[model samples]
Target: MQQLRISIPKPCTQNWADLSPAEKGRYCSSCQKEVIDFRGWTADELQDWFANSNGRVCGRLSQKQLDYFKPKEVRHEGWSFSAKVLLASSLALLTSSKVYSNTFAKSDSAIHQNTNEKGSKIKEEAKPSDSLIIIKGIITAKEDKLPLPDVSIFLKNSSVSGSTGDNGRFTLQVKATPGQKLLLEFKCLGYATKELEITPESVAQELELEMAFSDEGLTMGAVVVSYRRYPLHKRIWNFIKSPFVKHR
Candidate 1:
């Protein structure tokens, strides 16, 4: 199957949080369309969905996925509209560059230990398994190398999450194989968000994750998303409105 490479030269300004949830995606009452959230989708899944899609798609994606596609940006010196990447017979003209931090947005976080229903910390014995990945580490500030406390670390799509204690130490565990790679996010208030790729083999040694102090505010990588596939009419509409897109 051909690879799917999507680009969005124009970023949408509408806040997606207000949109109501639906079966497939969230409905944007303003644009009268459903915005699919493809935050944790695999590259093969993405390629399959785009291959079969028949209508216009407006969805969201991760910065990692963008890097994998490696969409090149070009400027037309005398054009009034912007340019975007278009797949041959499979155009994905969307506001894909609108940043959505999915990796750090995994919010079911608990610090140092697991808690029960009554909020009591649960201490369970961790047995090393071939299918388990334990990421134990100390989080620090990138500039001063001082250990940072209250840092939330979690897997991008999984429920496995943990935070650091006052000593800036944490142990996060997840279930995956040595071959499967997963995204890990480090997040803390007043610090720049950070991410890492972890595998069972790589988790053998302890980690020392670092984050930048948020001078202005917490910052994350831009994540482009699309809702659905676009048919010919929508493409024409986009062309008429922007009039600056170039495709192959």
Candidate 2:
């Protein structure tokens, strides 16, 4: 009979959790030189290491260690019916709110624009028509044809009055209807008073008035002396008694 010899593999003495990091490193160097210690590795790190090592057993790992370091499959479930309904409702509410806000803003802008247009229209309708006529003229001396200042121009039946400026120009604005007759009176201290009658057609053109010097100084003095006496009867008697008293 022939003698036979056989070699048997040794049972693993240290598990992944049983050995400290330094002891595992020494053991890996002595036994499996290519094995890496994956005791403190995260799931992602283990998975990456396993993938890089082509799923080769790196070292002796217990079942607990394997389970702890195994990468869990991420089972993503599609949106549930209730979740989809909630999302759709929220989106619809947000869209409706935005639409409502935009519509309200546009309506407010249109309302303001319409109100402004109506206000402008009302103002236009309420505006008054122009009825005033402007009368402008110049005063001058009749003899020398030179401009005269401080001449008074007044309307006969109206309170409108104006005086000539230094340039002998006068302006009067009065309200008058079409085809109405306007009476203007011009007077000065040493000049004879003059009157002018104008229609609207004539007022559209500028006017120039010449005034002649008057000799009413003596006549005015005689009139003043006649009124010196107060009573009406006495004034009349004195005027009769001394008609020539002023000449003397």
Q: Which candidate is the best by lDDT?
A: 1
lDDT of 1: 0.62
Error of 1 at 133 (Å): 2.4
TM-score of each: 0.36, 0.36
lDDT of 2 by residue, 163-202 (tens): 9987889998887777789999987754678999997668
Q: Count the backbone clashes (under 3 Å) in each candidate.
A: 19, 0
**Mind giving the per-residue lDDT tens digits that candidate 1 earns over 99-141?**
3334334433432233453354223333244375677889986
User: Model 2: which residue pairs collide?
Assistant: none
Mark the regions of model 2 whose C-alpha exceeds 4 Å error after superposition. 1-130, 218-248
Q: Candidate 1 versus the native: TM-score?
A: 0.36
lDDT of each: 0.62, 0.59
